[model samples]
Target: MNISHLENQTFNPSTFLLTGFLGLEYAHRWISLPFCFIYMTVILGNCTILHVIRTDSSLHEPMYYFLAMLALTDLGLCLTTLPTVLGIFWFDAREIPFSACFTQLFFIHSLSLVESSVLLSMAFDRFVAICNPLRYGSILTTQRIVTMALAFAFRSFSLIVPLPLLLRRFHYCRTNVLSHSYCLHLEIMKLACSDIIVNHIYGLTVVAFTVGIDSLLIFLSYVFILKTVLSIASREERLKAFNTCVSHICAVLLFYVPMIGLSLIHRFGERAPHIVHILMSYVYLLAPPLMNPVVYSIKTKQIRQRILKKLCAVKLIQT
Candidate 1:
């Protein structure tokens, strides 16, 4: 198409393009390898965690229930972007239909919000376990766990439903080129020809109320946990109490640190190097799913032993 014809194109285009990385076109094949590895790790790791939890009757507790929920969320988050991202890197399939783009955007952000909420629930799990040992079972009963899981799903669905709908009402006259490898609300909204003040406002408001508040509550929960740990008279008891939370603490930091960094870079580092944004985005999306299972496996004795036993049984059968 001629330049003039392209410029005069209608606002309601059928497809949108995703530019994975600006200057890395030559290295798309190589880059996709690592991403493929990461995706495999994420899927296998979370699935293993879920499988182990399901098979172990001793793990039929509130903490493991929350953990199963977290694993499911991680699976959702990774799968939401995996298809389109790998397609761009491997097959040059960057043109996404308008409706599919909105659907991907919805799942990605909603799963992220769900993950943040799951982390907060895990923090509360730790807090109750550490702060009220005797009442832990009474507080986080099976019924309560089911209720919380349903609530989390409902809240995420409610908040994320309006985002794509809001964007659908906008007119897109500019080139519908997205910066990242996948569809996101802010990135997609940036292509709109019409005003997006409300979009921007609502996006920020959602992040603040959901992720922002979740982060604050997680930190506060840790603060109380530390206080409770310090009150114990014996040094070994204090250490033991803190040790139980070490895996969760690592998971929290792995998740939120990159997430917050990416948010800050997006808002303030307009002039930052492109690679910085790409790396931060990858870390934010990939780290938790890949690391959570490893962390829990190494730190939680029950899971570790069960995994070892299962491995041995498989090895024996093969031999």
Candidate 2:
């Protein structure tokens, strides 16, 4: 409505929350090269993993299907931040427009919610496989996988669509410069001139429902898995069960730890090292995408060998 008025009222934050990294003065420049390499590798690696799982008939089980969904969510997460983040570092346009900032915040969190849901689905799949091996095929059917995926998509949309729309009702006159590298909802909310009682309440409620409830469900699934493993009464069977879950366990820890850390810092330890804050965001968000394929390949020997065989086939075709 009032374009110029919005432009003039905003203060461009010179330093962001993650300003204290590798070297604060030239952190953006210094981190760019390595960050780009890792980011590219993550994208390519995830794409390859997804492609292999989708194309190879033998790899189309529920576990790998869930993994493909994980890769898709990871790609969405990276796409949300990569353009703006890289542009900020490589070019001069470090400031984001208000509309764009809110868009980024919405997608980032939406994809995050979707990723969490996918993980929950994977846990359930594992539980069914380990606890009721006979019924695994019947339980995790094609129609069921499609339903789980749709549920994840629907839940993410239902949860996050309200957030950005609600945020639009608030007027951010305090300062437009977001502290973090990207426009995080909480970080940006701190800049609002209007009373943010609604925003904070909505945020906490969503967190409690999605992250809190999903985490509890995941815990219950694992508890059942552990109990089933223990009942086997053979050390070999116990180790095998533990081994099957190691990758998912690693992924869950990587995701939830930094998430909890970020929430804590955002809530109480706002004064924590800026680099710590920044790195934690990437570790929490970026690392999950990067590690998902590696963890799955390492733990699920079939996918690992399939990946290796695919690579070998490519090499032979080239040679």
Candidate 3:
């Protein structure tokens, strides 16, 4: 199958987006250290959370299972972009090979989509557990959870597979300097010499189908949750329900708010500062992973206690 007309293009941008304030040209030293720190924290924190979820027997429920999946996705996400991003910052290799760039775009986008779907599933699980307590087990059975997880994976891969292939269809005739650290779809689309009408339409369509749909469903789930809480006769039950969801709500906002902002900024804030855009991108991608563990530990007593016990055990072993 013939793909992407490899006409052998070269890019000659004096400065990449990471280099400084867009084309304004600023020092790389300032951003590099901070970016490195963020990348390390994201990787290590998510890995720790993943390990906790895996080894803790009490956390075998649907909630923690989904949380582990979230950590896994975030880990993949960091691996997808951060290493190349750091390389670009630390080293000066702005020229990404066409094939490798497209592949990076594929995994990053696929994992992001999967994260959104998984969040939606988590919201649905919460709704069932809080609103229909008796049916929670039957509704979210182990088999059903596995099926949902598989569906999330399949959907993400299916949506993103088309993007790289579509990008591969085009010839690299013009600028190869990706504006952002990684090879995002929008950045590549902008670089294409041919008519990008199909690319834009297809990209927007998928975004709407995946991100938009998932976000809306999450909103609706919270709506039902709120209604159920309001109608409950016992104030204790209502408070418990609300408390249980606080962490998930925080995580959802951390994930989607920046995403929505980034989309809006990319679409509408064209004249805005490039630094602003770059900062927003980092927050959108990194903030969720950073906040997730904190949210869980703060809101879920069991997780908090388990983490504390582990900390104390380490201290005792040291002593």
Candidate 4:
């Protein structure tokens, strides 16, 4: 627990073995089929969202711009986990170098916070648009958006930088086998032989203050948005303001529901089956990235129109 404890030597594994499901090894190849589809869809969907926002002049507003940031975070998560996730299934490649595993853990944690922050940002954008439509343009300018993006990115990066260093000091005397297909701070730290009280305390503090608090803020933002929408003089105005938030509400649910589920399972479901743990982890990581783009494209008329037009052109060329 002491920084001076760095002087103590400990056994560090050359690599850690990542695992799929506990008893599902026999079905890994079969399971790979759906996961392969999911990964492909996540990449294509998020990429399309980003491309449409970037090329289409109509999407230059703060809302779509924040959507692009969400897409980037999704892509970042996919890039971080894709290799080992697919590798574990198709090639049976479970071995990850210790340093590589730590790096993976870093990105996985950092991008998660970035995703949460992006959701809050989108909610705030909606709040401003609904409460003060006239001043929305003046408030959320391009410079301000860039500044917000950097501020969150810096926050996520700075908070996560200590994890790898802190973890390096821990001794793993037992099996370095991880519970899931990817390296996670929780799973990796489970194998530590030395006292991990400090790691646990620090990690929980980060989660509570960062992601947990941000989720609360997102909710409060929507509460204010709803109040503003309700006070509107016109029925059409209320509906219009409320409808604009449907996509963001869906995005928030997609990201947070499985996240909360995984957390709950870990906290109270200690006796839960091993596969339960693995399945929940997969859902938390894969579902949001895959679903967010789909939900947004379906709910946001501008995005949906662009995506549909692109698809029609592609279909016509193929025919």
The digit string of per-residue lDDT tens for model 2 on 1-319 reads: 1323334554554322222233343566776787798789789989988888989999889988998998999889888888876775676355666678778888999999998898899899889999999999999999999998998899888888877787777776555655456778888777667888888999999989998898999999999999999899889989988998998888788788889988898899877866677777777778888888788878888888988998899999999
Worst 10 residues of 2 by lDDT: 14-23
Model 2: lDDT of residue 24: 47
Angstrom error at residue 95, model 2: 1.5
| CA deviation > 4 Å runs, candidate 4 | 1-12, 316-319
Candidate 4: tens digits of C-alpha lDDT, residues 188-249: 78788889888889899999989999999998998888888788899998887888999899
After superposing candidate 2 on the true structure, give the runs of residues whose Cα lies further than 4 Å from its correct spot: 1-27
Best by lDDT: 4
- The lDDT for every candidate, in the order shown, is 0.86, 0.80, 0.79, 0.88
| Better candidate by lDDT, 1 or 3 | 1
Instruction: Summarize candidate 3's per-residue lDDT along 214-276 as a digit string, tens digits.
Output: 999999999999999999999998898899899889989999999988888988998987668
Candidates 3 and 4 compared: the better one by TM-score is: 4
Which wins on lDDT, candidate 1 or candidate 2? Answer: 1
300, model 1: CA deviation in Å? Answer: 1.6
